[model samples]
Target: MILDALFFLVMAGLNLFFWAIIIAAVLSLLTGFGILDTRNRVVWTIGDFFYRVTEPALRPVRDRLPNLGGIDLSPLVVLLLIQAAMLLVAAIQGYLIRGGVYF
Candidate 1:
């Protein structure tokens, strides 16, 4: 029972992390293209926060990836990696549950 609860909690955490990355990626693109104006204080605050938090993870990928015309593909790559990690976690949890392994 405890193992199942732990697995669910971990899965929920992974989902939240994955969604944050996805949201940050979309926000970055919108802000970059000037489609999202941060003139308002709230907008600016949210935008700034996400940029500061997500840029570190994104910078390395952005540097390694060659520029593709005007569109930056690094965020897409990051999103894919995040999804992969979440999927891996879910798979492991499923395996443990099926294998009757409990901690």
Candidate 2:
């Protein structure tokens, strides 16, 4: 019972982390392309936070990936990785539930 609870909590945490990455990626793309202006202090702050948090992950990807004209594909690659991780987690959880395993 406790194991089941813990598994659910961990799954929820993963979902939250995944969504945060998605949000940050979107924000970074928008700000990078000038679609979203950081005119207001609050906007700048939020955008800056996401930029800093996501840069460590995206920078390496950007460096390895060849530039396609002027477009950046690093964020798309990162999003795909995040989505794959989430799907893998869900599949593991489903398997555990089906096997009647609490953990």
Candidate 3:
């Protein structure tokens, strides 16, 4: 029971992070295209929030990846990794269920 709850919590957190990455990427695009004005306090605050939240996870991936001018693929890579991790968590839960380890 507790393990199931723990797995659920982890999956939920991963889902949130997954969306955060997507949102951050879109926000970057909007800002770059001038669709969103950073001069606005609300826009600036939201952008800053996403940047602070997502940058730590993205920084290492960005640094290791070779530059492709304006194209940034780090978020896609991180999203893929997050999906892989979610799959892993589900697989572990399935294994535990099959093994009768979850009750």
Q: Each candidate's lDDT (Cα)?
A: 0.79, 0.78, 0.97
Best by TM-score: 3
Q: lDDT tens string, model 2, 1-103?
A: 7766866787787666666678887787788789888897887998888777778878899999997987878777877887787788778878987897844
lDDT of candidate 1 over 65-91, digit per residue (tens): 988888778777887887787788878
Model with the higher lDDT, candidate 1 or 2: 1
lDDT of 1: 0.79
Predicted structure 2: lDDT: 0.78
Q: After superposition, how far is residue 38 of candidate 3 from its true place, in Å?
A: 0.4
* Predicted structure 3, TM vs. truth: 0.98
Return whichever of 1 and 3 wins on lDDT. Answer: 3
List of clashing residue pairs for candidate 1: none
